[model samples]
Target: MTEEPRLSAQDMIDRLSPVLSLRTRIRAVAALLAGVTGAVFMGTLWWTEPGPLPGRTHLAFALLTVFCLAWAAYGGWLLTRRIPLFATDQVIAAWIGLVASLATTAVVTVVAVQRGAGVGLPSAAGGVFVAVALALVVRAQARRAALLRRKHELTGREER
Candidate 1:
């Protein structure tokens, strides 16, 4: 019996297929773009006086901006490192959905709190829950699409 040599991480990277690398780099570009967009918007919105925006509104935007930029950086970093064994594209998409929803919820909750509505926080939480649930659904669909694509590539036949 012959024994095979173990491959190092660098060796694996060196052997990575051009197609996979291209795909990953595309995702990375998307993440970087999102980060840049968030930064631009945040800068434009907060650069000058808020113009009657309450304190809570400022906090909400700041939190949302932070989340947006952070996730974008994380996604780009993962793609650059080719670490998608766990953080797959579908997972990234879901995270994007969840993050956007959470930001929206933050704004809504702030408005609700400012209005003195005792039920606002719970309602905002419920909205976030729904958004996450929808993202999960999207993730499942994405997984299915990827599987179908792989199957097509392997069999040279498209599944109806």
Candidate 2:
């Protein structure tokens, strides 16, 4: 009788945890939802009661968007190159990204306020709220990655 070959770590992961795959279908869907929601919010702001943004606002948003995209890409690369190593690195990266996002938001908010916008104490508080929410999301992603790794390990799969 012929025996079936054991699956490699990557193959096992692909079959057993499709959801944890890099830029998985679910993640793509989530990204789409987030992008659409953000677009709608920006559209609403642009169409109704559009406040004058500071000249630096566009540059700041662009830079932040780039930073976030780069971070996501790097995470994807890490997952592909070394799936076993991804969880720990991803957790650290997520925290760093959260901090960077918060700093960017705070600096831009302050700039906007200084540009004679009606932004005040409440706006600053809103920045804090946004930062907190971002941190929560990052932490959630990191936890998910860790859980997936643990699940894989518990299944007796050989680490690649």
Candidate 3:
């Protein structure tokens, strides 16, 4: 019997429909906007400081600005890319986001505690961030699993 041809990535994507849902696209736009806005605000504050800041403060500002720009770049890349391999990409991005959120929360909580400030507000905000990041992680994993299942089914059909 003649063997059937395997589907290429593009062929599989064409059959699978839209690469990203509207929600995901909206998230990308939001990330891009938030990152840009944060970077601009931080840069302006740093640039307009009337007095000389400590070296540590300067380093902190620079690091924050770079972090914002990195998120902006990631969002822009996500928006522009049309490849079908983003199921894995989304999973990776989601995990990175979760880790970042956790780290930021820990830092904020520690700083607030050390400064003799009430930890209530910081803890609440951190909880929210962690929750959202966790939700995204879950959604990304589920989406990736669904895609893999569909890919397997399609490949099996092609073999038949």
Which predicted model would earn the best lDDT? 3
lDDT per residue for candidate 3 within 1-160, as digits (tens), equals 9999999998987876757667778978987898899899999999998899976567667767876887787778778756566376688678768877787777678777878897999999999999999999999989988887787787763211
Candidate 3, residue 140: CA error in Å? 1.0
Q: What is the lDDT ranking, best to worst?
A: 3, 1, 2
TM-score of every model versus the real structure: 0.56, 0.42, 0.64
Q: Once model 1 is optimally superposed onto the true structure by TM-score, how far is the C-alpha of residue 23 displaced, in angstroms? A: 3.1
Measured with C-alpha atoms, the lDDT of residue 116 in candidate 2 is: 69
Q: What digit string (tens of lDDT, one per residue) describes model 1 on residues 23-74?
A: 6677767777887788778867776754687777677668767866876786
Superposed on all Cα atoms, model 3 deviates from the true structure by an RMSD in Å of 5.7
TM-score of 2: 0.42
Which window of ten consecutive residues has the lowest lDDT sum in model 3?
Answer: 151-160
Which portions of model 1 show Cα errors greater than 4 Å? 2-21, 50-53, 87-89, 113-129, 132-160
